[model samples]
Target: MNNNIKRTLTTTILAAAFTVQAGENNFDQAYNSVSEADLRSHVKTLASDEFEGRQPTTIGEEKTLDYLTRQFTALGYQPGNNGSFLQPVELVRIEADPNVTLQIGDDSFEYKQNMVIGTSREQESVSLKDSELVFVGYGVNAPEYGWNDYAGVDVKGKTAVILVNDPGFANPDSGKFQGKTMTYYGRWTYKYEEASRQGAAGALIIHETAPASYGWSVVANSWSGPQYHLVTANGNKDRVAVEGWLSVEAAQTVFQKAGLDFEKLKEQAKNGPTAKAMSVKASVTVKSSLKRSKSNNFIATLPGSKAPDEHIIYTGHWDHLGKDPSKKGDNIYNGAHDNATGTASLISMAKAFASLKQRPARSVSFLIVTAEEQGLLGSKYYAEHPVYPLNKTVANLNLDAMNILGRTKDVAVVGFGKSELETYLTKAAKRQGRIITQEDRPEAGYYYRSDHFSFAKKGVPALYAEGGAESADEESAKYRKKMKVILNGCYHQVCDEYRDSWDFGGIIEDTQMFFEVGYDLANSDDWPKWNKTSEFQRPE
Candidate 1:
């Protein structure tokens, strides 16, 4: 071969080799088109101190959604839902009675200091209203597992007390529920849903930071503000009558009075008998006022050339922990990593898709939801009122909290293998010299915690991937320690602010990999399926 021809052919071969082997490092050229810096900048701004922490149903909501809509418009993505970038998400805002009081006989406890309660009910005012209280051990009614906490009790118009997670969660060996891998039972939301379904006037979930995997202050900080929820024109079962969390000390005091061993009895419920209602034999009366309001969900879409009706969605909640005026230090819970990063990634991915010459075989929707901290409310609303039919929707790619802990050798994925989405992830991770690790604690129910669950419940496969918990530049021990620290501190706290010291390398890599996964799905003709045992599997 001539020298010039040989040199050109060799360069082409080398480029092809990089494409097939290590495209993760080719991030510059691979995403040569992607501007992660710009994405991060917008995310930083949205999650900045000025946004008031991006709380739903507030001015913060207005600024965050407006910016997102503008960005999507600039990127040439069409408004995803009905030509409107902003989809109104009506919610009933209910704050606990500031001077709220809880009582058992002569024992009375103060609000915030002791217990807090609120509801999704639309009534201008709602009171526990002299409702009799019943102790419902674990208060779970899992007919699928032949278990019923309300088996013989009549809590028709009373209050029920329940434990936090599922039975097998505390002790890893019991295996009744998804042991330690938080099943839906582990979620406090499920407890209230079951209570409301049973027509209970009120329901309280006992809180233990260890079991709940979060703190009670999480309750106080999260609820002590304007809450947002989906407002149904017809508000019956759509509303959860009375729902809130209780502190451990409070639960201990209440359980002590009934002469029942709360912790011990909880251990017993693991395998011996199905969970049952304890019947504290008391009544609760909570008088409170409510206000109704509406919020918006920002959506953008890239239509498919072949399967215009089929879709692959990317979603992130635009809301944050928000600032608490009373809290000391940094008042802003600027959720930079918690989700601003995720939402920003959605925008960047949309831009990349918009820049593509060949459109995907299936459509792509970028959704920025509201009120995620208020328990995935916006996504739930979308699931109920979808712009595109569920069956035609292929998959959901969810970004919640991405790791800012420098770059790592691996990227972890939650709910990694419940659906065919994992295959797409595997392909992307391979390029990054990383592999998808299943959530270390499945019992924590990380899968059900985010908006992705909204789609999973409707049979659309979903992937919620996170940047690695481990850091490559740091020692393995420190990497693990960093993981521990993030869980306890900064997560959902006012301290979760943006830092210039953060390593965007991992985030950039993760976003690109996420795009590649969705891109493959969007361009391919494959209809991913659920493994037979997956609870989310579609029925034949």
Candidate 2:
């Protein structure tokens, strides 16, 4: 065998041996340290009315940081960020005026109803006046996929109207673009990014329920409020002046006004690039109020006994939607299931690791980030300016929106089959009498929507798993139906409050399994690898 191959084999064997030895050691005490009662208490406090929904740059952020700091200090964890628990993330908040209307030729679309628009640029006003409209199918420029929507078009000073989701979404069985599984290219974030790269002055995505995954309510609620992005030296001038979404109805009206058939174009888009210029021109002006502030990413670490430089990271976002005074009855978002549960899980996990009889060979870090509701701003900033060198970072295990339903016979691994971390998770789950399963909805792009994605983009292995669809008890079908209702109704709404009747059985099981996986990685020299089929690869 070649020297490199032989060395790799030896390392793998040694790591496996270390894992087996570590598995044999007694971890019952540490494993049992995570209690349902403790988790409930943390979630209750964080999601309470006094917390004001835990929005960053508000009073809510201050309270959340203080609470997390105390919990970590009590658990005997040292600050992971250079003797300080807080890593300052500079952010720019922009709230667009509500009265703005998007004009497409003679049709005018109102904000939050027919359309919603905003800008990432750090300015008071951004305007696109009488710019030509170009239909750039999927707005994708993937060379590997042999697709370039703007191949021969000059959208430099025009507005690019794009479609939501990827090409494979419409025909999952056609063997195109991962087949029903949404890729990074399918995300709305990518659509805006690609448009900016094409030098488009504005980008507007047509939203369809099936393709976009969520309903128009989700889009309206999320985009209407204040927007936040990491502060940049150039004020994000490279980005399009305006980024927005159009309801399916509004898109059709605009297309008809331009003497085109929207449905036919959508079909042509599915096959390949359909970059066509429309006869209509686009005009919109966004006047925004800007606020510059600093949010904190709270980090605490348990030092490794052997290799302190190597790290295993646990991440959870602490920020939520914050209170909206414009509403009458309930103003607070109280994101209990959305993320309070995940934030609390970080504390529970930290407690479990602290109770260990012997420290693991590698370090474990708990990172509670801010501004997740505002498009993962906190995590994105951390990824770009990492507290620890990305190379030394072992893996990122993210906790978000934990299951409040009863225990399940299986665990749902989001973005499954992407990494070898699943091997470790599967082994740990089997011991708990549970199996690992793929996420029920792969087209939602859940993997790219969380904090773990930040680490994943940097080529570090990441895992995002939660309670599964199959219940442990006899009422499996009934349990699944109930979960569906809750997930669909409460997501990003004021109704997502903490409930007294929530069952913590599933969360406990999932949390315990997470502990086992992280414990194994911490005690071994194993470097989990991404699957060859995965689009991400570790940088050489």
Q: Each model's TM-score?
A: 0.89, 0.95
lDDT of 1 by residue, 280-306 (tens): 543344454566788888888989989
Every candidate's lDDT: 0.74, 0.89
Candidate 2: the clashing residue pairs are: none
Candidate 2, residues 83-153: lDDT per residue as tens digits? 99999999999999998999999989999998999999998999999999999989998899888888999
Q: Residue 483 lDDT in model 1? A: 48
Best by TM-score: 2
Candidate 1 residues lying further than 4 Å off, grouped into runs, are: 1-30, 129-131, 233-241, 274-287, 326-330, 473-488
